[model samples]
Target: MSLTSTEKCAAAEELIAGGKLEDAEFLLEQVLDSHPLNVTALNAKCGLLMRSGKMAEAKRLLQIASDIAPEDPVVLTNLANVALLENRIGDAIDSLEQAHGARPDYLAAILLLGQVHQMLGQRKEAAEWLTRASALQAEDPDVLAAGAAFELDQQNIVEARRLYEKAVETRPDHIRSLAGLARIRCLAGDFDKAVELAKKAHLLAPQDPESALVLAQVFFQSGALGDADKLIGRFKRRYADYAPIVLLGAEIRIAQGEVQQGLADVAAWFRKAPGDAARLVAFLKLLGKAGDWQRILDMCEKLPAEVRASDAVVSLQEEALLALGRTKEGWQSWARRRNLSGESPCPPVQVTLPPRAPLLDEMVLMRFVDAVARNGRLEVSGETQIPGMWERLSAAASVDWAREAAPDPQLLADLAARATLHAPENGGFRAYLAPEPGRRAMWEAALPSDGRPRVGVFWDARPPGLLIDHLQDALQDLNIHIISLQFDESRHQLRTWRGVLDAGVKLEGPGDLVNLVDCLDLVVGPDGVPLHVAGALGRRGIALLQENHEWYWAGSDRQSIWYPDVERIVLPIGPSWAGAKPALRETLERIVPALHLPVTT
Candidate 1:
């Protein structure tokens, strides 16, 4: 039997919903041919075009439908969808808003508007639209779940939890609501509940990557490496091209000591999305950890000029050059750290110091020098005997102790242009300051002769986040003599480890801190002044880093340009230090073997 135009349009929608796009398109075209002004047929044809990835044709059909029925909410909403697909965000927003204005209670338009606002990073507007949608459809599971997801994005945890719970209550098997709740629980460190919720969501939709990702993250963060690995393997098989899954898998593999495999995974991810700066930096870091200096330099050189000149890329390049023992090239690259604004120009100034005067004011002068010194134009009067002076001096300009020259017009012009003029580029800067004879003699005399390794320890950095007690307890079993290099607020932690420390070493009022640090076999501590001092004095050290560390600790590379001999042990991302314990233990084990100390315990 033949069907009427309206009947054919209805049949087309059923066909489209049943996944028969070709049949639906043919039916919709016949309906539109007979009834060109039929908004329903026009909208259906636009949906079919969109589903088939013919965005331009979809938009044209949507426009025709909108013209035929200017006040039709469905036609307006479909047009907005077409606009969004085309990346015309502003047009999508305008269309959606107009649809909502035409029919204030249209739940679909309200929901779409909420999503579009969220996509534009307008969370407040998204919340308003979502709230209105919820009001319009009080029992809609999708609306409740979307509202909960929006709350989660805004970090309104308590409200998000409430909304997600309500959504689950309304529809027990809502996958997104369950996943939303699971994410909150995971972030709150309630891994057990998070696992339970995520598992339930995964069971409901086993192939859903979002649910699986949440579950995998919960497992990894809870230290269930085996479960996380299994989940990651499944995800890789199911969604091989998924970037987050690939990155997470790489991290898990690296943490499991499959360094080469993990590195390969990271490189593969970068190849897939080469323009992602964060991932590119991550790949370069993995290459560095593998000690592939040649590859690091080569990969860096091959990067687009803009990417190569970025701060992160430049920093990695500097580290690779320094690691390869190319000091001059490394220093030249390191000078790129100066991010200058062209608006203001400051002329290079050579501060002349009277004899018997301090070379530069330690407190105020260093800050200014660090900010303005470029290319080597900021010259000092002469070399000073001050113990910590050389380190700061080298950062600005190389000292010409014997042949002093006046600051010329060329130097001033270079400084005015904010050119790289740091003196370290001259290749003659000393790594450590020359300590006074008396201070050096005192430190040498106080050196420990106990056949055991002398390890310097500093347990604090102003905003404290160190595992001091745990570190002290762990060190108690090692056969090494501890020297406390702590000063200022760090001195308080000394009482906590006094029982295990040797009483012969005098830490109180020890003058010339650099000379003292230079005498130690190795320094180990969190990011702090003592670590910096050790690095400056050309001493070997171990730096304990938190996940959110200073910019100097760029990438996963253990090497630092400021402290070439220092190795970094970065803690995993989390609120607690539990994840870091294993890495710390492994580092200590490596250090003991390198120091030629027998494994005592």
Candidate 2:
């Protein structure tokens, strides 16, 4: 039935309040058709547009309302809300200031302004407003909830948990407080605690899309994939209009290796929520992983001009272009990533061919130095480590004989110092020593009076980024007592070491690590816990290094600055990309002779 203008406006406000935004927008459009200057209808329409996520249209409607009633606190607050949604954080702060100035005790504007500052990475500014809001209303659930979010962002997990618990105590049905607590517990590896909080949140806000999303994430993280799938299905059926549930369900399906099925599932979500930037980027990344570059290119062509120009879409487009071997276009687009606005341009690395020779000479080293000077820094195997730095200098010396410079002892010492103390590139930087009380006493008891070569043996520990299968083979040949510093049941693998050295020892977590360092004759591992601990303790150890790992292990060459008493067993790479397998027989044959070499004066 056609209604009067006043009746239509009231009906729109009722629908908006009920969260039926589509219905509200429809009614507002009909009412605004005749009474174009109806500020109340316009304000309600702006809010409906916001709920629908049509931020541009929301801003337009709010602007019209502001034009009609320029000084209205309500209209100004609505404008600020739209600005916050669009991430115009500074503008949101200004708009909120104006709105609150007109209405001094406006709680909503003050709270949202604080949240905007928090999102902008202005932690101090956010805390100020949040503190003010809390002072104004100590028991307000929303104020307490925002404060908890601020604390969580700062990584003060203890304070965040306390604040969230207080928020829930004050308002038992506060969904934000419940979800925040659940997320923190999940991060701390307490899945059981997280599940309990999530269940409570789901019960309180049964119809809220965010609650269902949080529950699904908690279930997924806890390895209850089936329960997550069921919750997603139930949420979809109940809140068929909700788009986030469908998107999250698709994400879960992708994680579970049902990529094709997940794509089909999210098609409806894309239809309902067109131009979802995050979803579109995620879909492209999935396609890239599956080697579907052609399909990604098709999507790029079909995307709207504005969406294509978006930072996420543009970065994806560039990646697709590069992967498709469009090198010229790819490099041209790469210019966008470079800070070319600076006064001086950064030069590219100069490559000097090494005449396909067996031995790299002083001239070759000179060319390597020139290349490093040109490029600003040398990268070791595409990683910014010292070995990479030396290799580039080696390359520069290859071209120009005059550029060659012998190793400067002082410079070498400084580089080694920096690499030991500051280089976290390969998790090798360990400047601080751990104090091991019990282990140190145990080691003191076992210490030989004559000081026959002390060797520390760490057998069953896997270092980060090592292939576990490879470490097992390497362990069999080394003649050393196996000490297990692993937190898990890898001690069974100590059979090989036991066969060689005839002794086995087990060390617990950090404590065992500290004690093991005190008693070892020489520490040996395929670069595991003992390696870092021994290095930090300034102990002598032999590092069995993987071929490509020399850069990360020793910083430069096969010598370590962190542990001066250490010798590296490196598998030197030859011409081809084939494995750098060391001749173990030859290595063992030379080890005794090399160790017997008189200390170079």
Candidate 3:
């Protein structure tokens, strides 16, 4: 018996549900050939075309179906899908809303509307639609997965995990649910479980790049570099022009110790995406690390003015200038850069009278005077000399005191203006100081008669934690008596190194810093207050730096303008501190011989 048109349409729907897309397409075409206005046949054919990735043909058929059955919810929903694929978000929303109006219980349309709103970043509207869909079909795996995706986007990770788990339980082989779970696991630092779930998703849908990418990232984070490298290699071959894959490939190369090649890959990305400011900054940092001062300067010049004036860019520029031996130009550039921050200028205020006793306020006022004098603006009118302040400040600023008058009100105002212009945000007011007589006396009285060279060491900064013990171990092998200049909360870290080396002496407080710094043969540490103090005191020092160090340690050169007596050694990029051991050893080897010290080992 021959089937009727309606029966053929129902049979085609069944074929589609049974995964026989070709058979369904043939039956729908036969029906449509006879009944050109048949909504069911048109909708079915549109869905089949969509499933085959023929979006243009699917859109044409969906339009025909909508025209034939103006009130058909299924037809509207299919039309919405076509609109969405064409990037017509408003059209998609209108179609989905019309579908819901046509048949209020249309679960597919409700779910799609929710997903569309989510994609548009309308979180509140998306939640409303998703809540309605969930109420309508509480046990639907698709609904559960969609809800999980919303939760994930909102960063409600716990709820997302629960929803995804329920989805996978409902439909054990759901690829999206598995992938979602894998992503959550990866973020939670459970790489082992993340890899397992990601592998399962990849196995189920081998062509899906998301699952493969997730698996590769899991391997990378878990320190399985070989696995990540292999997977990334395959992805590069298969998805050669994929941007995310290319970026990950570059990172993987860097992790594998191909620093220059990896940097070149990043540079290629920068060339392709010139307008990405973050990427440009990252590229400049890599150039700085490679000691490519010319390239750093050239790239900074190419940047937009606003970007070029940014703190990171200006810092790199400063480094490049100083490295190129343009010290005067670099200092002037730094002064100008400091003035660009748009902060209100400091008010010209009169200096307050010094406190009768040697109080903290008096010391602060004295330091302020010292800063004023260093700027070459001090005009002392009276013979009330503040001990060593005038001579120290004048010497540090490289100005001759004989050419200038003593400190006065006008001089104080000029100092205030220059201080406001040149003072760093951290208040690093390059004030000159003679060693405190009292602290010097105590230190001299306690000095051991053995006459071993004293090296001052401090390690740690505000962020970017370092392996201080490794540094100490390297230093301990140098046959020198070490002195701990570490203070503040980080001094607690010293306990770990004490037993491994000779019990080195330590500074008692901040007061001892001046005398102690003046006492040391050399200071070595991460760029911080100790190094700054050593530099100010004219002591030779070595600064261990990460790749993206602060602006003060500008340039790739061994020397700094802020600390002319100090040299810098920068660690490799990517695994910066992790790769510092060899660099530190090599630098210390050169430095020890240059210092004319006997090598113990």
Candidate 4:
């Protein structure tokens, strides 16, 4: 009944596939002890060691396997795996390339190369490799799923969905295809179908880490907290701390108001084994939530050299350093953001936004300060009213601003290929954008009676990073008249305001906003377009920076080089808005009384 070394190695592969690492290890050892140079035995043993978290041992054994069969593609790929585990990205890539070179048609090497190239932001190489893989194994469900996953990561949802559909049709039992489709559904907000797909994936691989994590996330986000909790309990210790399951458990707990305990759990997990990208992002956000800037900085030092350079971590660090008075280092760190790879899914499209990039109108407004720049025309088409300074910007930036709800994609592509786009981060310097005379006159007619200083408030209702839900409560006890300067989709939330004039509805564009801001005693909001506009116009304002902050307003001594006149208030860690209210009152008491002027004539 005894098995040969080859037979034992075959059985060991089955055990590893079943997640029975100990049994797999025993079988591999028996074969390895007799046939020390057996490649199959060594490869299977490496797999078992890696699964058991013995990366060093796995790597050492792989070196021996390489010597035994120097050109073996499988051994070369395992070498890549070990390098990846240690975060040695360059070495991993070299190994993969060598494997592919040795055997260009090696399907395993091709698929892995496609995945790794995508992870490293090598989109051209990834596309090439993926195309090759598809050509080689067009009907294989696994190949179809891998292609879909790569496309999904690049945010090509339609292409990914098409591939996933083909994959499921080819083989409905493929676990990865099911899970990939589930995630796409979740992103599309079809939570019911997402739950169904995730459940099928989990049922197919009840003990698999990825399947469990995906199901748990779908359940949690869809408000099936009880199911998520039970799933977490089932796999809590079965998966390691570095797996996203740990972060998922802590996230569920934090969402339920167990902030302290949830933070502690993540802290311990990150301290022990810290370099998974998703885990690091969540951990750093929680650290900021707890106001632990020093530890966040400390994490930068403790991280693997490759991970420390990630755009996400570095961006967050820039914000932390700015908040901590390390201006020199913060800006230097932030400057690196413009070119970092592998972090962003793709580079910003190269082109001039004539109507210009709408969301970045504030940045564009700053660039229009130069007289020579004002000589161009910008053509833009949109459903909403033309933004303030539309005509002026075309004159300033050489753009022709237009009005169209739907623009032709071909026209945009042609314009972008040759258009000159402008950026406002010009050495932190800017010229003031003056309010249009007519809009200023209209705003003057709507000014409040002279007495209790009028302050325009813009707490974004969408709450990307700032949301003070109790704006009414904060203003109900103050002496100031709160004008609703909020705009866009967030303007509708002002219906509940008592005795407030909804002036946000009146804004025509950035120029209109400038006119309103120019007339107010003070403008108050989180760091946003309004605050950015206020600073550009040399107006007084209070900018509330919460735990999750952007580096756009990075300046030392609570001053932004871009908005030096505005009072910068960094909200202390913790999600509560209790601290912001006090700062608001103090800034108003000190500044509003010093200037009692009427709306600008």
Best by TM-score: 4
TM-scores of the models, in the order given? 0.42, 0.45, 0.44, 0.59
Q: In model 4, where do residues sit more than 4 Å from their true spots?
A: 1-109, 121-125, 137-236, 241-431, 434-453, 460-465, 485-496, 503-519, 555-558, 595-601
Query: Candidate 1 lDDT (Cα, whole model)?
Result: 0.65
- On a 0 to 100 scale, what is the lDDT of residue 54 in model 3? 66
Sliding window of 10 residues with minimal summed lDDT for model 3: 354-363
Candidate 2 global TM-score: 0.45
Candidate 1 lDDT tens digits, 163-221: 88898897787887898888899877687899999898877656556677888877877
Q: Largest lDDT belongs to which candidate?
A: 4
Q: Report every candidate's CA lDDT.
A: 0.65, 0.57, 0.66, 0.67
Candidate number that wins on TM-score, 3 or 4: 4
Query: Candidate 1 — which residues are off by over 4 angstroms?
Result: 1-197, 200-204, 263-297, 303-339, 342-601
Task: Please say which candidate is ahead in TM-score: 1 or 4.
Answer: 4
Rank list by lDDT: 4, 3, 1, 2
* Shift of residue 433 alpha carbon in model 1, Å: 19
Itemize residue pairs with steric clashes in candidate 1. Answer: 374-421, 374-422, 375-420, 375-421, 375-422, 376-421, 376-422, 398-423
**Deviation in angstroms for 31 in model 4?**
22
